[model samples]
Target chain A: MAVVVQFAIGLVFGLGLVIAGMSNPAKVLNFLDIGAIRSGGWDPSLAFVLAGAIAVTFIGFRLVLRAAQPVFGESFHLPGKTGIDARIVIGPAIFGVGWGLAGFCPGPAFTALATGGGAALMFVVAMMAGMGAARWLANRRA
Target chain B: MRRSLCALAGAAGPDSVNTEFTPFASFLGGALIGAAAVMLMATMGRIAGVSGIAVRLLPPYAGGDVAGRLAFILGLVAAPVVVMMVTGSAPDLHIEAGPALLVVAGLLVGFGAVWGNGCTSGHGVCGLSRLSPRSLVATGVFMATAIATVYLTRHLM
Candidate 1:
């Protein structure tokens, strides 16, 4: 049952990405196009999307966090770390540059894979490799 | 695709025809994403962070729920198929960059997301909703950098 709910959430989230045009690389690029904003170019539609998502989530978390335990779990598994560090800043900066360049984040990239396109395939492989490399680096540090 | 290009070509002034703006749909989609994250939290006590979940499914991540992660990923990949069945067409996915650039971008995103402990969905959506200070900073940094990179690549270049 837990797995089923998780799968359903994934499905719904994926469909949302598709319907919102987020799965489209071009849409993402345009959203990130500060150049366009400066030149009076196309309006970034992603802001609305993010805003909508954040609004609902902000409310949802408030209500859910009040519960002592999850509906199907013993305890909530939230993130543990809470410090600002080089890894926090530098890592996302790098990710942001890549996001701007390729316009393919993890969620959309996975959805695009179903299309069986070469570009999507290439991006997925490289992303996996990148994640693997990060793990190796973290392991070495630990 | 061509329509988006035209939208890009024109001045997005108030009077310019907004050909590519889909605020309603985007909002609906975003609402769905938020609901999913909420459900994940309410039911399983997990963050519906795609990048973090994906990384946990990979090596060197300790004591992760392999089955649940696989189910989630499978659900993600299956969404397009469901869309096709319902709408009779898949979403438009085009990458203008060459292979090298695509690979480089992928690596950077993958590594950075993991190293940073989250991605757009993880930090931007889930964490921000929880009012985590770290997520706020992460989102701000990534968004600023993303805007700057696009500026450099699209306008400056």
Candidate 2:
């Protein structure tokens, strides 16, 4: 039942990415184009997407957290880390650079796998490799 | 709702920078994504953080419920197919960068997501919704750097 629910959620999220035009890298690139934003050229359509998602989820969290426990799980699997370490700051900085360069984030990049062709494939593979390297480094440090 | 959002973004005339403004579609899709996130939390007590989920499925990092992770990933891939079948519209993909740039960008994103502990979906959306401070900072930093990078790449380069 849990697995099925996860799949269903993924489906909805994936469909949203496609319909929202997030699956297209160009849309993202355009949104990040600061010059355009400055000149009031092409307004960042994604700001709406982000705003809409955040607004709904913000309300949704308040409602859901009221429950003693999640409907299907015994406890919520939320991130517990609260410290603002170097990892947190530096990591996003690096990710932002990549995101700005390619306009491909994980969700949309994965969604792009359906017909992402060579570029998308290359990205996914390289991304996996990077993740592997990070894990190795973390394990070594630990 | 879409109109209001577009208006808020200053996308009123045909001369707007984003001439291909699809506020209705974008807002509807965003709402769906939000609904999915809420459903995941309410039903399963989980955060629908895509990078976190993807990392768990990778080798050496695979420890948690692998079956569930695989199922969710399969669903993500199937989404476009379902859309194409229903709406008969193919998504336009514009990746002008060559494989070298793609690889570099991919590597950076993967490493950063792991180090930072979340990606856009995880930190920017679900985390921010829950008012997580770490997520808030991460989102701000990433957005600032992303805007800067775009400026450098497109305008300066």
Return the top candidate by DockQ: 1
C-alpha positional error of residue B56 in candidate 1 after TM-score superposition, expressed in Å: 1.3
The sequence of per-residue lDDT tens digits that candidate 2 reaches over residues A1-142 is 8888788889999988887888887788788886775555554668778887888899998899899999977888888899888988999999999898888999988898988888898999988777777777888998
Q: Write the per-residue lDDT of candidate 1 for residues A1-142, one digit (tens) a residue.
A: 8788788988988998888878887788888875666556655778888887898999998899899999988999999889898988988999999998788889999888898489889999899888888878978998
TM-score of 2: 0.90
For residue B13, give model 2's deviation from the true position in Å: 30
Writing each residue's lDDT as its tens digit, candidate 1 over B1-157 gives: 4334533643221111222878999998999889889988998888888887887787656557777877888888999999999889877766666688789999999998988888999999989988899999999999999888877666554
Which residue runs of candidate 1 sit more than 4 Å off their true CA positions? A38-40, B1-19
In model 1, what are the clashing residue pairs, if there are any?
A40-B12
Best candidate, lDDT:
1
Output the chain A TM-score of model 1. Answer: 0.92
Residue B114 accuracy (lDDT) in model 2: 87
The 10-residue segment of model 2 chain A with minimum total lDDT is A36-45
A44, model 2: CA deviation in Å? 1.1
The residue-level lDDT of candidate 1 at A85 comes to: 87
Per-model TM-score versus the true fold: 0.91, 0.90
